[model samples]
Target: MSSMSAPSLNFLAGGGEMGEIIRATDWSGSPLGTPETWPGSLRTLVQVMLMSGQPMFIAWGPERIMLYNDGYAPMCANRHPWALGKPFAEVWADIIDAVGPIMDAAYAGIPTYMDDIEFLMTRHGKQVETHFSFGYTPVHDHEDRVAGMFCTALEITSEVAEAKARKADAERLREMFEQAPSAIAVLRGRDYVFEVANSAYQRLVAKSDFLGRPAADVIPDLLEQGFSDLLDRVYETGEPFIGAGVPITVTDTETGTTIDYMMDFVYQPMRDADGEIDAIFVEVADATERHKAEKMQAILNEELAHRIKNQMAVVQAIVSQTLRNAADVRSARQLINGRLVALSSAHDLLVRGKGERASVRKLIETAMEPYGRGDGRQINLTGTEIEVGPKAALSLALILHELATNAVKYGALSVPEGHLDIAWGTSVDEESTTFDLTWTESGGPSVDEPSAPGFGTRLLRGGITGVESRVELDYSPGGFTFVLSTPLADIVIS
Candidate 1:
């Protein structure tokens, strides 16, 4: 068999590995035949691709045989050398699904351009992500018919990766800005134009369309509050200013009403690339609720101090009266100490009820708790739920203390077997509402009425003050009994 000699092609005349490989490759086994037998158009296209510095390639004939310049070798990675003289589909089988349609369009004489096309190529024995901007154009033969597809590509993997990283960073920053708790705004330019405002800032100003607008124009009220001046100073001097408890008035867009609020804010200068002050960054924290709470606490403290002084004066009077009425120092001291304890017990109940009204049953139980074990063996209490004003609770507490003291000294609580039943109830008529209480003692030593009433008896009878108040004492041989009746109107109802 005779074979045609290789042609003295200009493209193969270059001193490069690609040119050497082309000139040395055997053409008898190839479907396209020898270089001398190749058409003028294909030869001309190969010469133009070899001399060019850009990355270019040609896939010729129905088999789409691969022919590329030195510039395109790096893009082939480990697949170079072996990739030459092979079909385009075999050289790029990894991305044939993506490049097949583009090649088909080009072969049909329709050029295809793609920007930043991504491919997952298995190069260097590992899959790598790559990107490229490429154009596929039709190559015509001497007969002016589509013969092959020509491709020119530039790798853009690094650029595309950098762009993705930048986009992710921007998205994270936006999330942080939107979710910030404190009001934050970023202004740009010497005019203090609003560039970025978080949700908090939008809520603070009661508006959202502030971007690209001057801060002073968006919030004119800030001009009077000196906030606009602060921004100007920060921008001029490139220094930050912080203010605490600054008052500002804002209008409610929904109600068209003006509201005054206190804010702790800062105006910080933002610098440009040249280190020149360009704008101000504003951060604000609402302190109106905190200020109101502080004011209320101060007033409550003052009121509490005044009440304490009044209570001390009342204690002093009680001490003096008890000392004057006692027969001796020891007696006076014991009486005063017991009375103060009783007073403290009433105050505790009042405190538990927030110093307003106290339950009548709670007052009795608390006053008698120290004298008896709560098992109902020595002292028992029975009553309906009724709330009494502070004054009434105190008076009733003292009266109950006096009655319990008398029982301990000579009545029910004096003996081991002795017991007392303390009960109370309410009665309402058309004319008035009345409270009735009874203290009955049993299983104790014999009782007798005293010719001269002691301080305990006198206090119990006279301590309670109301319009229709009365007390009845019975000194029966079995035990001692006391009954109290009073108008319920004297005590505040709960």
Candidate 2:
């Protein structure tokens, strides 16, 4: 028979729209007779049928006879079939007490459910936590009034345990992302809103609070730099985009200064379950400092090339002159070799300093080494310790070497009584410092200004000018004078 065609009990238990409770014994009629015909044999056969292959339990009213199918009975906490047909409260009082609220709701004509409730019960002498979702439904009488309650539930223990485990794994993944050593951020939607950011991202954009803000809003400069548009396209097309050497200008929040940065990153689109693009993930690696160092290195290389060419031309000119004035080929070869040796010594000093900045004192000492220390009484050196960087030192050393050579031939140092004075001092002006050095000669042959410029005179002036400096040569009656000034800031000490 269908469930609706089944006969109901005579007693009204609790549940219905209108509240009423009456016992079958008080009514003075057969328990299953009168208007409600509940046949015991038919009810037993029906209960057995409903219990087949299902977790179902039945509680009859008044007598409160409890019954369960074989499938449902095994899940009970230590109870037996012999205990069936007894009052539910009498046989399994503890289980019934714990489930009383659910039963009460069901008897009140309201279906009740408990989702993932933990039940700690002893099984094989060991207590284990079992999770289950239980539901209780009301059984009605002949008058369609609430009578007893039925329970149908299954153990969801394994599913609950797995869910908890997965939740913990997800938490660990989140921690890894948050504690990463480099910047990390998550963007969402086509607009690429900043859904989340790590500590490193906060450090870069100090003033902007990135969380919950759109990427473009926090970094307006990114829009102009094409990053915003690039992300939008990547999201729209569900494609990954990569960039390198992207120049960006960022404001230093503390110093309020503009700083340049070079960055490289990839925009990878994230998809939803349906495989439609929903967001973009940006992975950025900053290389600003490295790029700047590389550029500076390139500039230094160019300067070194220019200086080498200039030095070679000077040496060639000196060799040509010596050859012209030589009385014999041996004399010409000897003079060229001596001058080349002096030039090589000066270059050795420059190289030892690693091209950073050369020491002015070292530069002069190396260039003058070829000239016998000249009687100390003949050449007077009076100067504060002023440094010249590599570029400046190289230029100044060449000029000093040419002057020393000319002196050995025709100036003050050419004779025993001839005297030379060299002095240097530094002064600062605005953003630049000027290093002034004076070279003066006296007590030599009364020298007159040459009618034509010589290689020594031209090189002294040209070399200094090539290195962004100035030189003034005077043909003084007393002997000769040379004044040179170069910027002090370019002088590298280390």
Candidate 3:
């Protein structure tokens, strides 16, 4: 690289370090012979490019010979001085796919401008992603033919990456809000215009006309309930408000019905970068179902307490009756124990917590259990399935206990040849549905009405105890028959 020192190169004198480098460069072996014979337009453009502080380059003649100023030297990394005399396309062969068309267009007398273009280039043995905003202008020759291109450019890789990061962050935030289970909403500005409302919030309000409208206008129920005032206070003070188990009543706009909600909610003020409140974030957790369940539990507790008191009264009556009717102390204990076991069987079904009801068939079987009687050989029971409430079930259990006791002592059950048959079925009349049960004793000694009624006889007559119930007794030479009729509604609990 020898100094030219020619007086004709004064145009190269004022371009700083690039001008000194160009002046000292040799041209004997170059395709373009010398500076003295080179095209004047190319020389003048090179002079202007060198003097400019901006990153600039020139690709002149058919070969696109490359020339660049000091400002563009660092952009080329280690390829600076060597890239000088090489073709621009060869110097940047790795990025030629992206820049080839622009270069062609500039040489065809057209200019191309781009605010941002990206390139992945091999820089100093490492792959680097870079962005640039540049313009390529056609440089005309002496005959006014497009023969070269001039470019001005600057790197903007960091700026583009920052903007992309912000977009990804915004998308993630939106997804988080939408997928959350709790109802979420955003109100912006002093008017409290709805900026966002997620799916849960839509279901809570049962409305969709919330966006771009003020809260007071779209959700009148909240406004009427003084919640609007509360929101305003929070926004003005930039403070957060939280409420737990707060009750709110709203009208169903479509159905015109009122619904109540119990909610645990929050109103959080959101601030901008400058610490000024710009919006309010709302979150609501519905608690209405929990409240209803608690209320039902309270009602059930009261029902159980009431049933306990009634059961105590029934036990006292059974105790007194057994003691009065017993012939001796041992018989009294046996009678009381049998009656209580029957009573316990009915109670076991009723107190199972499914509901206060017992199966009619199960109660009958239980009562006969104490007398060592079952339906297989000497006893037969046939009935349509029926369910009875606590009141009817208790009475039936006591009545059956008395009947079985009598049979075991002096009736059909007292003899091996005797047998008992109990059958029940339903009837429908104009007024209601009813049921009838018949207990018959057969194949025993001849029977007739007793001289006077005893506790057992009285219990049988009065035990099928609805006001509409009727009982009949028949004492025949062959058997004793007892029948009871009652309204079906008096027994069914569910």
Candidate 4:
């Protein structure tokens, strides 16, 4: 270790006057009257020395050290005045551990300096940690030999206590991070190497035994799946990356089957002391069961949509036929009962599918099967993943049945060579979802607009009323066209 430099030591009062004061006064001498006997210039010097901010002490005989001014005595103001003339140790034995080293250095003529030293000192029956900046310098005799030492110190107890409390709080945060519940990994750089992995992270990768490996090497599948790019982007730009509905393939050893997991994750950047991003904390949650449930719900929705349309078609046919074929009031009532029985069968299918929507393709095929071949090619269906709600499916079923019934009676399906082209597309128009479906007839007998709107038109228009949509039925000489417009949100895919 290197030696420390010597600090400056200029006494408040010079040697001659300080020596005189020491000789004129007893072992417990103070500056109260000694200044009156001295020269005016010396008296002025002693006054200034006594008034200095640093504590001052003088030794007049063996074992007696007197404190000369307000600076030194206030440090012990609570002590009895009769204790002042006694040896320094007798009055200050409570803090002798702190005073012994300073006194030894000064009396041996070796000056000492120490700053912010902490020690417990007894005051009013309580031990308080007293911080101090201290220096001890020996007084020289005429021949320059060591006589006694003087000590100077300042208290700084509060600062050290605050620093200690702050350190403890930081340590607690570190422990919490180490034991977090979620799968968390702190990564750094382009490779997103794991600088720290919590206990949950270890269990996730199934390698709790080797925690310090690079994240890329440990989880190669994650990098291959493009998760590394997200991690690097967050680390570089200091932005967070959040993702949901991400799938993970997990192999179960017991079942010998591949299990699919839906997961959500977040990658948040951690900045270092210089405000540069140095790490990223990755959090992942498994949502496999939730994803499976959503898929099942989509299938159920499609089924319900199919059943509701069929049920509405049966009701429309029953009401329209009963009104047309009744010979008298009693006969009409009997006919209504028989038609309602057919409607009841359709209602049974609707109840079986619960409240969710059903597949439009299946519903359309089912409605048209009675009129012509069930093969869907006869009715061109072109669209991407067109989903419909329960009410929309029921309404669409009625509309398709009405069109199919007309085609069998007087439109396309009545002829063996006739074909119905069904095409659908989605678009955003006027801040609403518009599903434009074009249904055209070809190779069929000539057709013209109905002389008057029939029960079919009324049922078609009323079926889609609950949902926001418009149905247009146009009849031309060659064939008929039905254009339907509806909100896209009403047909949202599950």
How many Å off is the CA of 472 in candidate 4? 44
* Tens digit per residue, CA lDDT, model 3, 354-400: 44777788878876654444746889999988988877886777677
For 1-494, candidate 2 gives per-residue lDDT tens digits of 12323346422222221112122122234333332455444354334534356566666676555655555555665655444455666665545556666667777789987886776755545677877787777777767777776767777888999999999998887687678755667798866789877776666555546678877678776577777778778877778998887887877656878767788777888888999888777666677777889897996786566556556655665566677667999988887888779778877875664466555666776766555443468776767776656656666776786787667666886666789888888878878778888889988887787788755566677745435667788887789898887766644431
How badly does each model clash, as a count of residue pairs? 0, 4, 0, 10
Model 4 agreement with the true structure over 1-494: per-residue lDDT tens digits:
11112111122233343333433444325433333333333333334546566655543234634444445554554663444445667677887787776776677788888878776777667776777776776766556766555566556577777878889886786577668766777777666667777677666655554455677677776577788677767876788989898987654333545556688888888888999887788887776677889997996686457546644654565455556656888887776776566445444434444367676666665555443244565566666566677766666766776677677666776656788887777878667767777789987999888778655666665546466667787778778988888776765432
RMSD of each: 12.2, 10.7, 11.1, 16.5
How many angstroms is residue 175 displaced in model 1 relative to the true structure, after the best TM-score fit? 1.4
TM-score of each: 0.63, 0.54, 0.61, 0.43
lDDT of each: 0.80, 0.67, 0.80, 0.63
How many clashes does the backbone of model 1 have?
Answer: 0
Instruction: Give the best candidate by TM-score.
Output: 1
lDDT of 3 at 219: 86
